[model samples]
Target: MVPLKKYPNYSSWAFLAVMAVGALFCSTVIAGVTGQFNLAPVGIFCGLLWVIGGALCFWAVQAEQDLAGTGLRSMSVSILLSFFSGVVIFQEPTLLYFSVPAIACMVIGIWIPASKTKSVWKNWRSLLSGAIFGTYLIPYKFSSLGDMEFLFPFSVGVCVGSVLLVAIMTLKRKKSFGYPKIPTLFAFASGILWMLGTLAIFWAIADDGMFGYAVGYPLLQLNLVVNQMWGVFVFGEYASRHGRIKLTLSTIVILVGAVLLTLSKM
Candidate 1:
């Protein structure tokens, strides 16, 4: 694979850290409450929390936000890709059903143009990293597992894939390979976290609505926000690294969004 064209900036990376934290908290909390209380109310509350919190994130971060380009483009990519969550969450949805379309949109939305400057191999690498990264970050539909139904297999898949991605990155040694050594651990952590987190949320939501509804839904946004930020910033992503301020602010927005949602739940 040819080396990707070099860039002068990497400020956006900060946001990824922000989003990861959000995913952890929100998913954990939501699981706690919904598993415990099983409240229909929790979902409704989350809906409201997300709306206001998302708006605030947009307000704080989008100074030059435009529909046609830059901010909108990346966000659009994230949304479209995230839309796969619906597929995963739906009852008995297959991997390809959700994965294919989501992957395609991501390719069109971000990868094609990116390919112009970078090699095809690098583009594919980004695709792999991003897809996995996104998976770990979101509130996936397939998050559930019936009694004795799906825990071991799921964990096996996660551990395998994570190890594979790392091995690929190491063996391939593609110059523009997006993953960082340690940060990629977060991706693995996310996979394991999602599995355990899902069960935890499942249990918690049975007793804890505040933790479930308020913390979980907004936390979804939080995870995605940082996921998007980091995926793009560290490895490769929707936008090329513009500068530090953009990255930092984007990161801040993700964290704040999670915080706001969690608080509103209270």
Candidate 2:
């Protein structure tokens, strides 16, 4: 945990900037190496949406202390929304028998952790963040470029968005942009890591990839499992027996839902 209080003067925008810079660098490198440098308007749009959504996600993470809750709320919502978008808008096959219950379990999982939180504003932010993260990939569906090819434009959008954020914050707060060195490095590393994961996701959902949008998208939400593990073991979250029980139960239910979703596509 980067002691939030220790850096009273740290700017969130500064952190976001470094992270975006890292992502930009990674994406540029990958695109160059793969020779996948096709640009499209939709890709740019996806990047812009990611900027807003990613910012909200960063804020939600900072505001919410429970890492599991943060992952569950945002990711569950993202899975549900993206699943439906794949089915309804993209005209993907509908496996109601499995999907209905899967959705129910996910909703239950989201509700359990969400009910524990006292901050209404934080809840709203998490929900909004999930909404954006969920739908930002829609434009990719329409683009003619390969998954790897879309990364460069998408990263450019992220960089542009970061710059806009820094400018806005500087002007509004009347303060220069600044951040602690360690946090900046961590943020940059995180961006590189995120870009790597994002590449896999893009490949998974690509038209020629192993899984199409409906299947690949929901399967990726399994990341919540890893997120929860960090919360429980590393962060010592849900230390109380009751909290642990709820976390375990919710996670099981969510996983069950995810399993059913996987089967639904078969």
Q: TM-scores of the models, in the given order?
A: 0.31, 0.90
Candidate 2's displacement at residue 179, Å, is: 2.1
- Which candidate achieves the best TM-score against the true structure? 2
Candidate 1 wrongly placed segments (more than 4 Å): 1-79, 84-123, 132-144, 147-149, 160-221, 224-242, 252-266
Candidates' C-alpha lDDT: 0.35, 0.77
lDDT tens per residue, model 2, 204-251: 888787667776787887888788777788778778888878878888
Q: After superposition, how far is residue 201 of candidate 2 from its true place, in Å?
A: 1.5
**Candidate 2: clashing residue pairs, number:** 0
